[model samples]
Target: MFSASRGFVPLLAAAALTGVLLGACQPQGAEAPPAATAGGPVRILSAKGLNPQAGEASPQGRLLIGRGKDYTPLNEDPKALFDKLEGSMAERRKTGWAIVEALLEPQKLTLDGKTYDVPLWHTWYEGMSANPEVDQKIKLFIAQLAACKADADCHKSRAEIAHEVMAQSGTDKNLVRSLVSANLTQVLKQSEGFDRGNPEDELGQGFTLFSPSFVEHVLAQAQGIETCSNKIPWNQAPPSAGQFSPCVEEFPRSAVMVKTNWDQIDGASPKVSAHATDAAAVTAVLKGGTWPKPTLEPVDPSGIYTVQTTDGKLFGLKSIHISTKDTREWIWITLWWSPKPDEDFGQDRPASLARFNGGVWSHYKMCVTTAFNETDPKPWGSYETAQPALAAAIKASYDGAVEQRNPAPYDKVTTWCSNPNLEHHTGNGRTNCIGCHQYSLTWNELKERPAYFSDTYAASMAAEYPQYGRARRRANFPAEFAWSFGMEFQEQIKTAREDQGFSW
Candidate 1:
């Protein structure tokens, strides 16, 4: 969910973010040391990074600031800086770092100078149904069909047998059909409505794509979650449909899903709204298209959008959520996207790939949070290509590397994370992507916590957040105000004073 000025509003940002009351929370003590800045303009070095104590020959020791007198430390408080990665995003856009293009693009990674290509998601990922325990469920479901078609039961139609399984497991019939025909091509085809081979079919705009980390979080959590469809209020919906994910008989967790803001006037339905319902007042101000700011164009007749470069666009504003297998953490994600520029930066329509540095658009930008709960103050905010030159200058000063030039001809390559939310945020202070997600959790289960996840994959670049149980986990604090993951993790530690007793 995002709140910014210029008449921007998400359809139901809070719908998925707000809800619940687990218990009181306390921020981590400053005594604890800083962890990975996660993903941002900063770098995560093995030892003292950049200008540890500030570089230079001054008696003041190291020159802490890389840019001018005022700048953020590129190598400290990784959790916080991981919140902003301007240059990296530009780099990521070119490399497919965790965007949907990752699936469509040919990927390569240089490790120690030897390049290794990444595997395709359809081949690399297996849904929970592939797990031994889950496989048993599938097998049992199959046996039901075999019995229905047995010699004596030849009178039973295949549809009859199919219905039996659906009726018995309370699953979606279409899902059953999909399982029976599941495979790489089929999965990819079902995931989106566009044609992969046709340039015209391109999403036409930057859209959100789920990363493998978010997928890992969902499947891992499926291990503990059960069908909420069978629960009290959830049961009122329909079979195979639950209040939470794992509610359906099974979800194709490995199937990477991406979506566009169809509510916009430029989307599939040009007549429909493309923003949050609660903020119609904001949309009224932008009746005339915005210039300088990224402009929006419809990708499909269905209302999906493709906006300008990462400068100022929320390509795919989506999130995914799931409880941890231990029921102690809530793995959720916040996703953003930038419309890849036309090959020639929109100088001409249908720009030739050969004329551009890369065959596709010039760049894309995105950010995400680690699988953290309520306690994480800094969810990973990675990428802003526009400010890369500045970031690189700072990095060069600290790392003592030569000033890097754009290997490609495009200029957006030098951008930095702009923190879209900050544009409309009331203050001038730089806000990270996690700023909004931080409110995505609460106490007492009085309401529901939204599940945030990604939608696409990058061909090469991937902005990765630490996994569950990693030492680099973000901190918790400001008791009484908890995050989804923190609240979930410490749920069992509740005490009378609304303090202490947390199982940790």
Candidate 2:
């Protein structure tokens, strides 16, 4: 069974965001103006996203060069610099920004005899189940499981089972490795897992997309390990189960995952606070079922990246959580739509973003983290240097929470990067992207449901949170710092086992 406490804090307690529905007769061409922003005039860059006909690998290569001489040019070999995963926090921040720029760059796609320009990442990724190869892989694994169960003394290793399956089945390894990914489905719970439909009170829809490289790495590991079983060698160390392949200089795109939170926009209102639910309200919010019923009708498209699903539904991007295996611990970055785009996390956003595609994306704010502990050196990337107000805001928020309970110490040294929309559960203001993710482990290792606040603070000056803190004081193997392995893969295998009529 999957771990009961998936390490998520909880959803925001705020009331659901509401919208004023427009008249049903409005023409599609009569698009409303983009939401007003402190960054200046809104630009309508392109009408592109999610082409149903285009496959995962359809749109490849960079679209635009990043601005400024220091930034790596995306049009060139951007991954070359990204692979560096430099030691210093400042350099890692720059690399993180460069990667985000590449992801946001528009790519061209044609649908129904018309051209649409969408962000490269949107065109390049799909839901994990969307890949046809995964089902085949699951079947092969199930066969291996049944064979082992039937034999009295079956001592075959995962490698042996994989070899046998490949030889007999002639499995196409490359096809499995080339697929894109998906399945986060809530307002702000993108990282939690796939298709967790919104519970009442949660506002928007969330999607977590994986690049081909990320899928390839996970598939390679699944092919080599028995993820569904609780009998994996528990004593094995770092390179064993749960640990993902590293992002090295040789393989730059080892693993790249993005989680985006979106709200349905009503073109008549175009308010950030508004949602498309008002037009075609959900008849009921399923507790543990599929997305709410009574499909939300499409509102007229406004400014910002908006997509019209094949079902004629519409969604507007609000926030994004991006974690790339750029560094050993990975670079944690988040961007969210804000009326005051130039303040806090959005401070120091390059002018190139404003100029690119007529500044359509200038309304989003960004923050990145490379190190577990925040040590601010002047003239570099720090909440203080890059965004002092953000640092103060985080501290203030933490202080308010601390009055109610004994929360972790809030100070300048606490590295912070919390998406307000996504990370609202518990003391989310005090939580960094690396904190909860560090607890990502296999089902066997996490069966105990270790203390969430055990290793929140640094153990000492020498070690970071993952190695030295109380939470990870015990020897454990991580599922590559990715919660999806347990939440998605194990769940999929569980379903597959049921399909094979195999009881746990």
Candidate 3:
């Protein structure tokens, strides 16, 4: 069974969604965005209207406005960054759906001298290592600091200032020693295991992508500590009397993060099922310690999106979790490939999606929750709406939470969400997206940073375990609900200890 830590993307086996094209996905017969020169500025044509920087509302009353590139000020005033997600449940779903379509547009990447047109979301800069240029700059700084490690005479130098900052913060002594004992390569690769899927499932490979704004905020904070600590300026508790920390930072409202799961199809090819592989198959794939590059051909009749890497390996997208900081609480959405997509989760998918990329998106079923629980006034899907599938899915999610309680005193509530490919094992399947991620926090000890507590996946755990529920979450929003950041912090600790020849 899978543990609470891991989560994944897929095309839908369901029927196509129907609705008006909201300028997120392409309109009828619209072509994918033209490929840009590799290493050049992204043209971003298809995402123009969806740009939250425009600060406008759509015809459906959805707030399209969101914080964008100029979001640095948002760090000082976190609440101002939140734009309430206004509109009915169906309208809100359209907003989320539009966001998904906008991200799915083709983005070209040059890997190993070959151009691959992957989804825009796939092109986000990998966070494990800073870009080469940035890495070089950091290395130079680290080298300078290492040179002045024990020299009392170098106190007035820039390197000394950096060392002093970290030393005063308490966590830096271990970090500096760890960097000195190990080569730079080890430190950069330390956080790479974040997307290793569940160690329990060998065929699974997951990737988490961060929006440029999100990365920028992280870098800005890192720069504050001389690029040594990945710490965000957060407090131990929520703000008092509606006042937020002037220095407390968070991912901007425009910050959109995605986690995608990939399947290793090797010889399975056309016979591959539109579902998760069994554990036996996973064990077979990981018989050795090495993770083989996935290889597989498309299922002949189904038009699911598959990727062939420069290494001659083939991989298929299995599931996707998209989250945005549009609202203060953020919007949670998950999409998975379903063999029977049009049923259950796919029943109310919009029809207009057929126009985008030749209906490639129609093969994916999606569900989204803007609030923690079902706050909709109507009887779930009782009202006539353009996106009944979204409404019903959300309702079903809350209902599932209610059922999980089994009796009375179900005071705590949340909408359930899980990806079949990503959150498949044990406690994961019954998890709520936000409910699990809300625990993305770390200890506030300024001296020695500790390891991260595991995340939760069981639905209604909040009601059963109030100590770690929303109240605890509200009091401790350490990583601002971005587990990757917290993981990065902890991985550094691991790298430090390992480099010092200490093994757990």
Model 2 / residue 60 / CA error / Å: 25
TM-score, candidate 1, is 0.26
Candidate 3, residue 209: lDDT: 53
My TM-score estimates for the predictions, one after another, are 0.26, 0.56, 0.56
Candidate with more favorable, higher lDDT: 2 or 3: 2
Residue-level lDDT of model 3, residues 273-340, one tens digit each, is 35422223222222221223333335422245444321223344556788877666677788876555
Worst 10 residues of 3 by lDDT: 172-181
Each candidate's lDDT (Cα)?
0.22, 0.43, 0.42
Clashing residue pairs in all predictions, respectively, total: 90, 5, 23
- Model 2, range 78-131, lDDT digits (tens) per residue? 344434332344455556667787676544332223223335454333334333
Candidate 2: the clashing residue pairs are 128-182, 183-194, 242-478, 242-479, 455-471
Off by over 4 Å in 3: 1-87, 106-118, 129-203, 223-236, 239-248, 266-302, 377-379, 382-394, 404-410, 443-455, 458-473, 489-504
